[model samples]
Target: MSREFLPGQVIVYPYLWAWQHERGETEGRKTRSTSVVVAVRGANDGLTHLALLAITTQPPEPDRIALEVSDIECRRAGLSDFKRCWIVVDEYNYDVAERSWYIEPDEPALGRFSKAFMMRIAAAFGQASRKSGRRVNRTE
Candidate 1:
């Protein structure tokens, strides 16, 4: 059975898109590549968080992958704080049919995976959205 998730909740799915950049070159050669989504964060603040697994051919193994989260993504995922907040995937479109992919799944394993994925995405979102020096007031 499928699961249900509320808005501002995180969701993680396999990455199905990739491309290349032609702006800069490394070591006098341009490199093209693709990436995958290992995790995603749901945003209560009005955005979605995505953590990408970047693959490259360098000193590290060609199969080696790195995980990275972008600031723009965090902003898009509506991340504001780092604790106790839920991460929701952004699947709302005014023109397209509204599909609910965040619902609670009947499968316990799937549910756990989804929740774990959301948590990871939330962590990434928090990292990207966290203020450098300012601390949030806890008493307020």
Candidate 2:
């Protein structure tokens, strides 16, 4: 597995959302651009754990938390096709790099967000995580 699990890196993934899983869906309905918000290697398992946030052109639902992506930031993140978009922060898809069947190791990343913008995203994610946030485990 040669995929780079770095913060801010955007990659295409079949991201199963918490709600979808709750509905007994085993896979994402579609492949979409997802941001690698966090990546930590477990000492015992030696696997890279990843937290992926979905990137969408549609605005988030009223109850969900999100951060708007600017034109420059979108371009930097290889999202120029989206004139407007937001990063959903209220929840994430969790996966182990070594065990994941959805993340393609040979695929190239779409792009990366700037450190500053990523910091903002991280902060929002942290805050949302402390609230009614949800996680969808893709490993199962």
**What is the lDDT of every predicted structure here?**
0.28, 0.92
TM-score of each: 0.22, 0.97
Could you give candidate 2's per-residue lDDT for residues 36-65 as a string of tens digits? Answer: 999999999888999999998888889889
Candidate 2's C-alpha runs over 4 A off are none
Summarize candidate 1's per-residue lDDT along 20-121 as a digit string, tens digits.
Answer: 112322121222121212323335533233232222223332332223324443333433232222222211111100132321234221112234444564
Provide backbone clash counts, one per model.
24, 0
Highest TM-score, which number? 2
Query: How much RMSD separates candidate 1 from the native structure?
Result: 15.4
